[model samples]
Target: RNDHMLSDWFRKNQEVRIYLGYAPEPNWWSVADLVHVFTGKIDGISPSFRNSMTCKIIGRDYSAPLIDTSFTVAYAARTSSQIAKMLAGKYGLKLNITDTSEIIERDMYQNRKEWEVLQALADLEGFICHVDKDKTFHFGPRQESDEEVEAELYYRSRLKSNCQVDFEDTAIDVYNQITVRHYRKKQVIEGSAKNDALIEQIGQVKERVIYNSKAKTNAQAKEMAQKLLPEFSRYVVTGKAMNMAGNPNLFCEKKVAVKGCGRFDGNYYVERFEHTLNSSGFITNLDLTNLRPDTAQQYRQDLYTKDSAILGSGNKLGSGTI
Candidate 1:
């Protein structure tokens, strides 16, 4: 009978609520703000013998419902920045994208969520997409700088409870040969790009092939391959570290440097970042990836670029991997 009663009680208290105050006070704000709802399952419950129940929580984005919409559109010769504006119009969102001269020849987004479509389009140009605190959509190139506060890595005293370092050297997917086949100008055009250094190091015959119809010509396919080859020709570095600073604004797709650790000390891009805020404090867990190799990050300024012929630029527009 006691076990049954306890189970009933546990189920009742699992209801979700927004807490504003700490214990011994009028916690769990009686008048909750639905606009700023923190939606998550009640993970745990503990009573401190004072009729006060402490709730363990997981943070969730409440704005997810906004971007979940179906749409279809055909775009031509539109830069990433322009596409961002068109998508953001549905939600009256202000679009802020990195300045780019790269232009898409043609793109068709079938019936899909605006969020998913935006991300897919951005990936074609090696950009990241996310909404910021101001509710602005940031669809920009991966800002690969160590100076930005959002991109800087804190070491020694800044790391909180847990820190982990990992690396994968035997990346079989890292390919040196790329063959892109497409139909153009009333005929089939084929182009290939190869990483000479990777071929020399691994062997001459390690080939990986792909078919891309996005590029209008054989030269465009070759250019696309050149931009992509460097990104795949490397072992991926990933790790998770806690940020004691509690920067609530931190989101995924930002870069950070991992210093003090030998070999692991390099610039890494955050693929996933989860920020948890509670009565204790804010804790951040990061899934990081080193897009560029150690030496490449320092000296390779023009990593990828748009063809001058397409954009009418005398020089190549800066480019990088998605």
Candidate 2:
């Protein structure tokens, strides 16, 4: 009573409407459309086409619909045949008999051109030339032997008439020319700057010496100050001027005098003046830090000699009295 057999048949063979149109005011309708009108559009119909009937219900012609389906099928079959032939030819299977003549003619032309190029290349010596995609020639290696120089020359002359040199060689020549020009320009600019700097340095040294005098002192102090001033000036020229200007802490300072002689403590030459004062029979003490270390030692030894001479003179004078 459930009709399982009927439901199984409907599930296996589903029915679909293949609509076809009739020509001359082309119009058509499916079987289901007529059936739906007759059955009140309520119950389902069986999926079997065995009891199906084709009814030419007389509203419009259906020839246009038939012609359209036929044309579509024919076009699809022709396209598939063309695709199959293309695939066979690509795989070298010769699917179409008519394509052989054209393929052989193309191969023959290619082989003949390649053979001519090989012969030309084999005949060259002293200079070998090749043609590029842009139809320009390049010359480098020689293919023929040295003994075949005449043949090589003949081939070279023929190639020269047929091909022009490549743009690459022209570009290389231009690049080399530009590089040489750039190098010469750089050398000229650097040389001029160096000359200008030398002149400026000479002028600065002259001005510095003219404006400043050597520190006034006896021979030893003068020698010490002279050695120290240049190094100090270089520091001032390159360093902060306000800090090193008159800052005596950055340099050595000294004052020296005999007890009886008036103070000879100017800015410099204290040690030499003290030695002279002590030799003249006055006791003296001199600060020696104004001099460099080696110069200070030498000055101290001179002062001691002066003191010993004075004491010796005083002892001799006292002995004369006794």
User: Total clashing residue pairs per candidate?
Assistant: 2, 2
Output the number of the lDDT-best candidate: 1
Q: Please identify model 2 stretches exceeding 4 Å from their true place.
A: 1-231, 234-322
lDDT tens digits, residue span 1-322, model 1: 2323343355422434332222333445334322222332344444333344343233323225335566566556566567667777566556777654545445445567776566655554455565544556777654556335364554542553234444433444466876665544337666788878878887765554444446668888888777667776665455656544444434444567776666777877654555556566655666565654222211122222223122223131121111
| Tens digits of per-residue lDDT for model 2, 47-129 | 33244332211111111111122111112222222322332233233232211110111221222333222222222111222
Would you list the clashing residue pairs of candidate 1?
126-322, 304-319
Q: What value of lDDT does candidate 2 attain over all alpha carbons?
A: 0.21
Whole-model Cα lDDT of every candidate shown, in order:
0.51, 0.21
Candidate 1 colliding pairs, count? 2
Residue 225, candidate 2: Cα error in Å is 16
lDDT of model 1 at position 116: 59
Q: Candidate 1 — which residues are off by over 4 angstroms?
A: 1-67, 72-84, 97-107, 125-127, 139-173, 178-191, 196-224, 243-245, 278-281, 292-322
